[model samples]
Structures are given as C-alpha cells and as structure tokens.
Target: MADVAAKERRILVAVDEGDESMHALSWCLSNLISENSKDALLLLYVKPPRAVYSTLDGTGYLFSSDIMAAMDRHGYDVAESVLEKAKRMCKDLHDVKVESIIEDGDPRDVICQMTQRLGVDVLVMGSRGYGLIKRAFLGSVSNHCAQNVKCPVLIVKKPKSTVANN
Candidate 1:
C-alpha cells in the first residue's frame, strides 16, 4: 500500500462571550482535531464598533470622556477574557497549533474576511438558535458566514439541557 500522509489544515473558530461559542470550540477540539496531525486552530474574537452618539440628539445627554474610556476598557476586558477561556480549552492538545486574534467590526463581515485572508480550510462557529423574527432583526452571524465564505462552514448548535421531572 502506498504511504498516506495526513493533510495539513488551518481551522478558524470564531469565539465570543456566549456559552454557545465556547461549546462550539469544545466540540471542534473533540471532533475535528486529530492526534499528531498538522492542524492550526485560530481563535477569533470580534469586537463591535463603538456607538457613535449624535451630538444633535433631542435628549441632549452627552457621554463624558471618562465614561467613553471606561466603555472602551470594558470591551478590551471582555475580549481578553473570552480569548483566555478559548485558549484554556486547547491547552491539552499539544499536537495542534493554536493562535488567537482580536478584531473590531461586525462579526459577520469580520469572520468572512478573516477566513479568506487567512485561507482557512474550514470555518467553525456556534448557532445562537435564534427564532425567525429575532434572527431577522438582529441578523445571524453564522448564517451570513455560511452563505458568504468560500470554505466549508461548520455551525455547531448547543443542545438545550433538559430537567428531569417526577
């Protein structure tokens, strides 16, 4: 038999503050990664753009510079926390190389751009399980990426936990 070698792949996983994203990361670690394979896993966190409050608003309430600074700091903290949690999940996997990236923009656009820019083999993300109305209003990141990106997209949906009753 001819010798076969494992294909090297670059997998990108979009992570956020939600438990669904973390669950998707966990699922990817368990199911996609293989032992001794040359796979690079990238963790991406997209920060939303800062709100641009209009000065001419009728309310006439303006945010102080200190408050704006605090808001920016909070965003940074959240990004750091989320990335740290994702890194911890991949700590045990020695064979697969892992990296983290933080970008500012809409998650839907940023994710698609990153996948193309990085030339990822597959794009992995979690589904929020939004209802039709909610998804229509808020827009689904996973759905946008799934339709726009060139690579295969794997959207992992976290199953809701059930409670036992007598």
Candidate 2:
C-alpha cells in the first residue's frame, strides 16, 4: 500500500469495556498504520440510556435520574481507562493522535452517527460484547454497525470453541 496522510484516514474503535474488545483495538493499531504517516484513532464508549419515571397519584415509574448520571460518570471513567490501557499495551501509539469519547445513546446508533460526523474510514469493533442477551435479540453492535455504517467495519472475535465446532 502507498503511504497515507496522518489526517486523511480516521479510525473509530467502539469498545464496551469487554475483554473481547481489546482484540479489536489491537487489530486497529497493528493494521491501520501507514508507512510514512499515521492516522487518527478514536475510542468511543457508549453509555446506555438512563431510565426516567414520573410519579402520578403515588404511583412510581421505573425511572431514576441519578441512574443516568451514574451511567454518564461510569462511561467517562471507562473511556479514560480505555485510553490508559491502550497506552499501556501499545506504547508506540503514544505519538499517534488519539481521541477518547464517551457518549450516551444506543451503541449502534451512536457509533453510526460518530462515523458519519467524523468521516471515519474504518471502524474496528468486537463481535460480542457485555450485553449478550440484548445483542442476541436486538442485534449485536458489530452486526448493526456492519449493516448501517458506510465505512469499512472489522469485527474481532475470540477463537472458536472446540465444542461449538463439533
């Protein structure tokens, strides 16, 4: 491949703080580098929506504002931890410009929006994640992202289990 410009290609890596996601991040670092330049790596952690309920006539709703706040806080912390761990694992990335973002919304939707807004050329994400049940029924983040996002999407997965293969 020819040399690429540092700013030309933007890569967005979506992680859900799952160990499986680390493989995706590592894949991005190892594959996306240019011979004469480097590209931007954006780490995004999506915070699930907070429940909100109103009390009417002493009836309680399944909602909590504090829950939302906590989710946001946790998301930020996860983003910070992600960057720190990335640095620890891939020290060479120290010179490459990177951005850590924590956003609140549906993982698939937010990822798609970020890709469009940032003009991302490549998206690296995990095949499976923290919410296995939701993903199984609603659609996995990797599956949704592959179907919706315009850019190329890479789905990282652990080695298959022998039991499953048999």
Candidate 3:
C-alpha cells in the first residue's frame, strides 16, 4: 500500500507560447517529478481555431485565399515551435516520460476536457499573474480549470527576481 501511494503520478501541464508556461514545465520537472519517480508528463498546447469571417454576401471571408492561408500558416508555426521547446526541455530526463499534445478550440474548455478525459492525477500550469481587475475582465483560464477539474491544480508563478530581469 505504501509503494502504491508513492508510485509515479500522471501529470498534465498546459503550455502555450508564453515563457510562463515553459517555466511551469521546468517547475514540474524539478519539483513534482524526479529521476526516481518515473512520472509521465503530458505537455498540452491549445490552439485557437482558424478565423472565420462573413461578408455581406453571407460567404466566409475565408474566400480570401491569401489571408486565410497566412493565418493558418502562422498558427501552425506557433504551435510547432511551442511544443518543440517543451519537448526539448525534457530531453535530458532519461527516466521521465513525455508526450506532446495539441488541441484546437477554446483553451479553457479544451484543457478542462482533456484533464478529465486523460484521467490526470494532477493538472499543472502557469498563472498569467493578472491583477484582480484584469482577471475578472479577461476570465482566467487557470482560474476556470482550478474550479472545474477534479484533480489537484498547481499554478506556478514566475518569481519576482526573474520578472525583474526580463
């Protein structure tokens, strides 16, 4: 019974293009996970769906091939870059397992859905560190997930020292 409780945990970390998310990944690896823990880390990146605009004719502005193509290209590039960085961070951890996950939709909804679907033991992410007014107006993803998910949620905030340097 003691061994089972100490067994590796299924940790899911939601990441994005921001440095905050990357920092959370590092925090998770160094703190929650260990060389001996054998924990599995799933790095999730949620991309917003492509823009769809309608004109007076009721046809999608997506008919603008050039504009649509550029938007799609940019989105794909960002998703790839962020996921790559997260994967690179885990390259040195020989004992830990890492999986890259990309989902398309509203980040708050997708993240919550995936957490429950994957049966994650803990959901870890970085807080935007927004002040009260900002979070209230913007409706924070971290806040929403914390309230909805069954698993424990860890919100890593970048330290003041690092913020000062940046």
Best by TM-score: 1
lDDT of 1 at 145: 94
Per-residue CA lDDT of candidate 2, range 1-166, in tens? 6545444578888877676677777766766664334677788777655321122213334436775466557667776786677556555664566777778777878999999998998998889864565464446778888999998998878565522210
Candidate 1 has a TM-score of: 0.83
Best by lDDT: 1
Question: Model 3, range 17-101, lDDT digits (tens) per residue?
Answer: 7778888888887887766667788999887655311222245553678867776777778888988988998887776688989
State in Å the error of residue 67, model 2.
5.8
Question: What residue runs in model 2 are displaced by over 4 Å at the alpha carbon?
Answer: 4-7, 34-36, 52-72, 134-138, 160-166
Order of all candidates by TM-score, from best down to worst?
A: 1, 3, 2
lDDT of 1 by residue, 79-128 (tens): 99989999988888777889999998767889999999999999999886
Worst 10 residues of 2 by lDDT: 51-60
Question: lDDT of model 1 at residue 109?
Answer: 87
Candidate 2 global TM-score: 0.75
Model 1 residue 87 lDDT? 96
For each candidate, what TM-score against the reference?
A: 0.83, 0.75, 0.81
User: Model 3, 70: alpha-carbon shift in Å?
Assistant: 2.0
Quantify how close model 3 is to the true structure by its C-alpha RMSD in Å: 4.9
